[model samples]
Target: MIRSSRLLNILLVSVLLPLAGLSQAAGWPRQVVTDNGTITLKSAPKRIVSTSVTLTGSLLAIDAPVIASGAGVPNSRFTDSQGFFSQWGAVAKQKHVQRLYIGEANAEMVAAQAPDLIVVSATGHDSALRLVNQLSSIAPVIVVNYDDKSWQQVVTLLGQATGHEDQAQTIIYQFDQRVTALKPALKLPPQPVSAFVWNGGGKEVNLWTADSAQGKLLQQLGFTLAPTPTQLATSHSMGQRKDIIQLSGEKMSEGLSGKSWLMFVADEDTVNQVNSDRFLQQTPAVKQGHVYPLGNDNFRLDYYSATHTLAILEKRFVH
Candidate 1:
């Protein structure tokens, strides 16, 4: 027979095991539903890696522990030398978040980070969905769809995933408050404005539709978006995407047939170029002299850029 002390020790060990599991379940074993499917985290992640540069802003907004991030083209008007968006580049630097890679997603580079969690965008130039299986072996991965949702929605989803719901709420509330305070102070420009990233030469354009974050923000600020022509809307160069429609040739003029044009990813220089372009002289927006630049920073609508957009609009349109 077992010694009396040994028997008592075994009984004590069994009693504590269930309680330990219960304690773990209380704060952890969190589940988040993502585009890729449901992901279960055994515990709160300490190190997070973002494969989408665009998603990095939202992650940083909620104070997620992002150890590294995929980057975009370096030193562009929109991005810094490290390829982080200019809006949050300083914040990323302050947090010491390293750039995982630029241009393409590299599985080896990501693996080197040894992250507890990996984030990928469902669609965008920065997406790493092709390497999902490879990344899953390293850590739990979640795919977020940014095109269909507003920036606020993306932050809320990420907050839930990263266990920063309160931080997310605080940011959202602050942004909403600013938007609310500014809404009544401004006189909206021409109704039904067409917003797009002008392809510079007037040869092509990436038109922002109602579903895009930029479009939603404009609408929230009380500007009605002109409905895109049915024909141009159905047929486009870029494949079916909810965010932007790529148009060129005759479609460029026909698609931009709005009372006013608000060019995103543009600055005052872009406005000057559009004003002087001979080919676009007859366009309704040009003929009416209603073309306005929404600034280069308006290209992405993360929390920082979105707030900047509000300031730009308020200054331009406030009575």
Candidate 2:
């Protein structure tokens, strides 16, 4: 009798929390501004076609039924990766979403999926503008660029666009609450923490600033940017703006010797390789056991990825 009562209470809370959240969202026929223009969604989308990996992952995180995804590539876990992309591949598979396309956006393929809403993002896709024009003729399209926005902001936009606004706001509220609670527990060191990714070149490393997607998360944790000065003036590789800076060999050695490190490399072998590299031999993080891996395959973080990142930080860094 006692165990059954406990289970029932747990289920009730789970069901009621979402109901309570939904009550706070505005009524149906919602409108959200998109890159294309003002988009008004008359009702919740039943079928959504996600044209980018980031959007696919974001949509799935909020319980949006993404009917198709652009994850048919060789590098994708959906191909055979067994959750190489932890955020979406399994969710996409569990939802039985179709693999619509890989490297290029296919309007016909996406159309055949019979989607009511098509989501395209400017990340990782070459022809966003052309695809938007093609899909607009068939159905409503929202062009989301997840690069510059905070994860909370991105999820809020996604929720509004997909009719999960209440849930989106709830996630942000809960996350901010958690952060507020966790702030008093961080045991930061004297020097700053620098996060980086190696290009697999001899000694080249790309450093992240406060504005970078991952760097934004780090900033919330009260860690100062290692190299200091959040943004610099310069346009360079991948046109990544000024937030990501590159260094090689002796230059990298000088910048990160005193700071702890966060490595966004894909796996343990690569982590070992980066630690052993001659250029990184003097890194303070490698010496003091402060070097940490975000995830082996989690090179680029999206909404779900950032959530996982925050959870891991809370567990590892807190007393």
lDDT of 1 by residue, 1-319 (tens): 5799899997885454323322223357788889999888888788999999999999999899999999999998789999999989999999999998897999999899999999999887888889999999999999998877899889877877787776777788778778888988978777789999977466678888888998899888888898988887875433646888887776777787778888987888887877776667788788778998877766678998898888889988987
Candidate achieving the largest lDDT: 1
Which ten-residue region of model 2 has the weakest summed lDDT?
228-237
- Identify the runs in model 2 with alpha carbons over 4 angstroms from their true place: 1-25, 75-84, 125-127, 201-204, 228-237, 240-243, 246-258, 266-268, 287-289
Worst 10 residues of 1 by lDDT: 17-26
Measured with C-alpha atoms, the lDDT of residue 19 in candidate 2 is: 43
Q: Alpha-carbon error at 144 in model 1, in Å? A: 0.6
Off by over 4 Å in 1: 1-26, 235-238
Error of 2 at 3 (Å): 29
Best by TM-score: 1
Q: What TM-score does model 2 achieve against the real structure?
A: 0.79
Clashing pairs in 1: none
Q: Which residue pairs collide in model 2, if any?
A: 266-296, 267-296
